[model samples]
Target: MNISNNVSSITAHQTLLNTSANNIANVNTDGFIPKDTRITDNAGSVRTNTREADNNGSKRSQTDLAKEIPNEIIAQDATAVNVNVIKTQDEMLGTLLDIKT
Candidate 1:
């Protein structure tokens, strides 16, 4: 198992979660441009990119709760999954070593 890739993915997802939380917190603040998190696969690892929009679509609001809330949930879920994967991998490796001993 490639633990490095899982670690990277967890980090990226955490960043995404933070960005979404920030956007939601500043939803009503004037002149606050919300940030969007973009994730991409780089080889076997994950990469994160954040983009700030000049305007929040056609809406007059500074932030869009409809979008930000769902995004935060998605990011949180993804992060949790990655952490579970890493734990599973570690357990499997330990079991293998025990059998060899």
Candidate 2:
């Protein structure tokens, strides 16, 4: 009946999506080194880390469209799955209460 893990997963994936979208938006901005996002799991809880790229001394934005696009898609899918799981758990809890009454 615990959904804390799913909630954390959804939060992590949302962060990932946000980072990817930011990278894509800054692709045309010069000297913008897009940040990279990673998901870390700690004791069944999910965490997101966003880090800036190394100073490569390049004025061009190093954000790659090919990678960011897929990353965003994957994040979206992960978020959706966690959301669905949370919804199902809520329904099941409601059903259990109904049975008891």
Candidate number of the best lDDT: 2
For candidate 1, which ten residues in a row score worst on lDDT? 53-62
TM-score of model number 1: 0.89
Against the unseen true structure, what C-alpha lDDT does each candidate score?
A: 0.84, 0.91
Q: Candidate 2 lDDT, tens digit per residue, 21-67?
A: 99999999999998999899998899988999676888998888998
Candidate 2: 10-residue stretch with minimal lDDT: 53-62
- In model 2, the runs with Cα more than 4 Å from the true position are none
* Residue-pair clashes, model 2: 0
Task: For candidate 1, write residues 4-97 as lDDT tens digits.
Answer: 9888988998898899888888877767778878999999889998988667454444777888888888888888898899899989999999
Residue 7 Cα positional deviation in candidate 1, in Å, after optimal superposition:
0.8
Give per-model TM-scores.
Answer: 0.89, 0.92
State the local distance difference test value for candidate 1.
Answer: 0.84
